[model samples]
Target chain A: MITITLFEMKKIIKSIFFFVMLAFLCVFLIGYYVFVHHQTVPVEKLIVETESMIHMQEQQIQELKRTINNSEDGGNSQLQLDLTVSEQLLSKNQILLKAYQEEDWQAVLQQEIESNEPEVERMKAGNEYYTSTFPTLFTLESRLEYNKWLLSHNITPVLPIDFYSWYTVYDLDFGDPIAEEYIKKQSEKYSSTGVYFLHHTLNLLFTIFGALIFLFLFGDILTKEGLGKNGPIHFLHTQPLSRLKIFIGKLLAVLFLSLFVIVFISGFCLLIGSLFDGFGYFYYPVLIYGEDFSFTFQKMSTVIFQSGVLFIFVLLFSYALLFLFSILTKRTLTAVGLTIVVLYIGIQWGKDTILSSFSPYIPFHYFSITDIVTNTFAASVKNFAFSMSTGCIVLSISTIALLFLSYFLFHLQNKLLH
Target chain B: MIIHIQNVKKRYKKEWVLKGINIKVEQPNIIALVGPNGSGKTTLLNCMTNLLSFHEGTVELVGKKHTDPSLFKEVSFLQDNRILYGNLTGYDHLKFICNVQHLSTARITDVAERVGMSSYLKKRVRNYSLGMKQHLLLAMAIINQPKLLLLDEPLNGLDPTSAITMRNILLELYNEGTTILLSSHNLDEIDRLTNTVYFMKDGAILKESLLDLNMRRYTVSVTDGKKAKKILEEKQIDFTSINENQISFDETTIDLQTFIDYMNQNDIQIYDIDKQKIGAERRYQELFEGAK
Candidate 1:
């Protein structure tokens, strides 16, 4: 079994496809490094966007005043209310722009809290907890607490206090494309450091691209061994080893090599980032989603570590699934294609309402490794079952199931293909 | 018993490729399975080695069931070169066989030398020629010094010298008490290797070993063939006159010594006698007559 596993790994490592995947990772890292300079959105740009908003609000307030002075309209009271709201917004923008210009992040955060606190209070008073902009009290409070945390920690704001969420858009958009782009680019992901670069790559990699890299790399493991009577796999089959050992050997090979590739990417990113910049804080706070719309923060290093653990299992689950399909299809591309289709459908359907109650049971829900760690997908879809522990359990079970099924089919097929 | 395949049956899709095949070998001897294509020769071999599951009956090698993978420690199958990983070197293949069979790593070098593939043993199988691949397959098969060696077309892609080497290696293994079951289309090579031949047509084996009926054919060339032919014809002997100076007949008709004694007493000078072991070839011709 060890020999078979080692031989499989040697075959994979000797393959040009493995090197190609490494090159792609290097290119992503180098490309990020080359373009990271432009990724950071300066506070000056935010200040300018705020000033423009303030100027537009002032013009609206002036127009309201002229209309009030020119005519004694019957609906002047409503117009006056509009005028008051517009004036309040105008003053809020002025204060924010000034704090940004002075680089007083503390004052700016305080100002934002002071301004939004009233709206949150009014919504509570009127029982209007949801809005298009502020969908829930959780969103309002999450952003408010995010700012308070930053203020208490004395960490300057790189992104808005709501955290780097995919669903929230309350950051400094200023109704301008430039401001929106600026807001998206303000994360520490653009920073040149070991922690920052790995975090950034981790966030991007847990998606389909990472799955595909390993899938394509090891996709042909079984098929290349010769499912046919004349295949090289018969060489092993004709040996004294059992079929179960062969399956275990290939399984171990995929798992070990997959872990190697994942770690290699992470280490390579860190090497490039630290070599160029420096080793940044592993304790940098990353937001973690909680039940009941509650939330907490974890260290960046912890997040990455946790993501690695879960992603390893996720890759195992994928390989197991692919191996099962390989036995059925007996062709590399077709097996990979079938696995991707199945995984894709599982991810999509798991997100949908078909069996929403069982989302946590679905292994594909944890496809986004980071999302699972942070409970982002769970909180987004309101299914608290999709946590990291649940992800590990579900994927472990699914992998074992697929492995058993695959081995059964492979055993049955040894004679059929003959 | 080294090989005991009893009433084994195998089907390919809807066709019965092996129908109630039975063979039992209790001693260490080379056995050849010669047949036409699609005559269940390879299928029976596969069934015996458990490479292909039989529909019915039992196959045991060296007292262990074929299904027991440990039987492979005492049994080796020299299949087509497709069983070789093209990306791996011949040395890798030999080393793997040794590892799987729990043999010493020292055997790889020994087997490579014995097969006369030592020079190209370290080269990738993809870079090897057809004969080189055959050598690697042979080396891998014999690396464990198995008690029973099953070879299917082992001489498929070999040069004359390599074929001779393979034959010598098999003979050596036979001398070492290895029981060999060989299946091939080359009757001449089979004849050279073993006298116990099984001829198959369709999905059944021809019942007898043909050893009882397999007689040495004698081609006697005398200085004067006319007198020899006249004497043989006068005695109502069955013979073929190759030319005026030569005549050929099987031992079944008359013992070679008796025929030679008659020629010497009749003042006929026997120039040369070519004795041919045509057991397998003749049986093959008779069994698969008109087969291309």
Candidate 2:
């Protein structure tokens, strides 16, 4: 079995398609870095711009105060309301600028929490506060309340300026407290290094491009042998080894190839990160979600390690599914097409539906390793919680089941070609 | 017994390709499976090697059932050219077989030389001609020196020289106590290689031995063809004339010695006598003539 597995691995390594796909992946990684750098405003530049806006608002507030003093019966009620809102906005901007200057996000969050609580209470007592006067401010107050919830749990806020940039510039929302905590932890750990950038970049890449890469890598593993002109399955089937062993050998070969490509791509990305930016510390914090939808912080190393293991499990499940389909269909294109269709549907429509209800149980739930590790799936989709250990166990069991079924069906089959 | 196939029946869809094939080989020797196209010759060989499923039979090699994983350790099936890996070199295939069979590297070299594939063993199979692929198949079959060798159309794409070489290699393997079950349409090669022939029709074994039929015929070329004809007529012997110089008669119908004596008594001079060997070709014709 080992010999056969080694031979199969050699075949995959020497194949031209494998190398071509790997090359394309590397190129895409580089292009993604370039696009991100072009789109994102540098932290220092954004801070400077925000300070200028704060200064201008302060001048307008002073001028309004002078006009009210000079007016006959003070300013009208509307002018008074505008003055109050502007003063509040100026204070919030001053806190953000101070946080940026000192690089102390926790202090800024504490001050903001202290400042917002009294206002929240005062607004809640006012009749027209939410419906007529300032509905959007109420929404902002709720987010502040969420930040207060994080602080009470001993978690620091990601700086408000960084949060604002992510929301406005990148159009990303950390609306969920759990998501906010994760972004905050990641932001602190990565600190604008290439590793930090790549860490975030890979999270997006895994969600979007993972299925396509898996399809290109393992789509035809079994069917190629059956459908080609040479029909090598005929030779393989006649060997003394059991069909189960043969299937396992091929499965291991696919895994070995996948790991090789992953490791190669990761190494290349790391090299580029080190040259362009610097490698981040291994002790950075990562936030995880529990089965009860509770959030917790874990070390970056542990999260990364768990993510890698879960990634392998997910890939095993996928390859096993493809292998079973390949044998059943006995045609490369049909098997590949079916696999792609199933994956696309699962990724697109599976969340927050009947499938998501079985979170940490169904293999489809574990397809996105990033979501599993970061607990995003649990937060976004109700009744679902992301657990790495559970995902790994579920995926492992399904992979084994799929492999057994594949072997059983393959052994009972007598014909190699149609 | 080296190979025992009992009550084997195979079907494709609703049609029976192998009705009930029962063959037992008590000795290690070359056995030919002769049949026309779609006569289930290939099917029988595949079933015996456990490459195809038989619905109602048991196939055993060296006293072990066909499903036994260890059976292939001592058995090798030489399939058609379609089974060879075209992207891999011929040596890669041979080495793979050797690895699975637990044979030494030296054995691969030896088999390559024996099958006359040493010159192009390093080339990929896609670059090979049909004849070269046939040679590689033969080499793979004998790499392990298996006790039972099953060959399906082993000589399909070989030239005359290569065919002769293949014949000699099979003979050598047989000499070394290997039992070979070969299926082929090349009757002359079959006739040259083995006397034990299994003629199949409609998915069943018809005759095990062609020599046992005892239907040999002889044609004689004589100087006095009219006198010989008159003598044959007087003796109530059946014979057919081949022009004015020759006459043909079944050896079984009239003894050769009696015909020669009658010719001598009637002053007839016999120039030459030839026996019309009823090999596989004639047996096939006689068996399938009515069915066709």
- Point to the candidate with the largest DockQ: 1
What lDDT, from 0 to 1, does candidate 2 have? Answer: 0.73
Predicted model with the maximum lDDT: 1
- lDDT of model 2 at residue B104? 88
Show where candidate 2 strays beyond 4 Å: A39-44, A47-194, A227-230, A291-294, A344-360, A381-386, A415-418, B212-217, B221-272, B276-292
lDDT of 2 by residue, A1-418 (tens): 9877876776666566777888888898788767655544454664797799899999999998998888998988878988999999898888778776776657666766776677667766663222322223333344455556555555433333233312111113456767666554434322334555556555654552565577677777787676323367767766787767778888888888888776776677667766765665454445554443245556565766677677788778777778778878888778877777776776566564534456457667777787677776665453454567788888789888988888777877775421
- Candidate 1: residue pairs that collide: none
Least accurate 10 contiguous residues by lDDT in model 2 chain B:
B207-216
Q: TM-score for all predictions?
A: 0.79, 0.77
Cα RMSD of predicted structure 2: 6.6
Q: How well is candidate 2 docked (DockQ)?
A: 0.35
lDDT of 1 by residue, B1-292 (tens): 8888889887878888888988889989998888888898888877777777878899889999998989989889999888777777888778777766677999888888898889998888889999999988888888888899999999998989988899999999999999999998877788788878888888998874446335778888898888889999999999988888989887888999899899988999998999976577776765667311
Candidate 1: docking tier: acceptable
After TM-score superposition, what is the CA distance of residue A374 in candidate 2 from its true location, in Å? Answer: 2.7
C-alpha lDDT (0 to 100) for residue B290 of candidate 2: 40
Each candidate's root-mean-square deviation in Å? 6.3, 6.6
- Residue-level lDDT tens digits of model 2 in B1-292: 7888898998888789898988898889788888878999888877776667778988888888888767888888898788876667888888887777677878878988999999999998889999999999998888888899999989988999999999999998999999999998898888788877888888988853445333667889999898888888888888888879799887766978888888888778899999867666666676776411
For all candidates in order, the CA lDDT equals: 0.80, 0.73
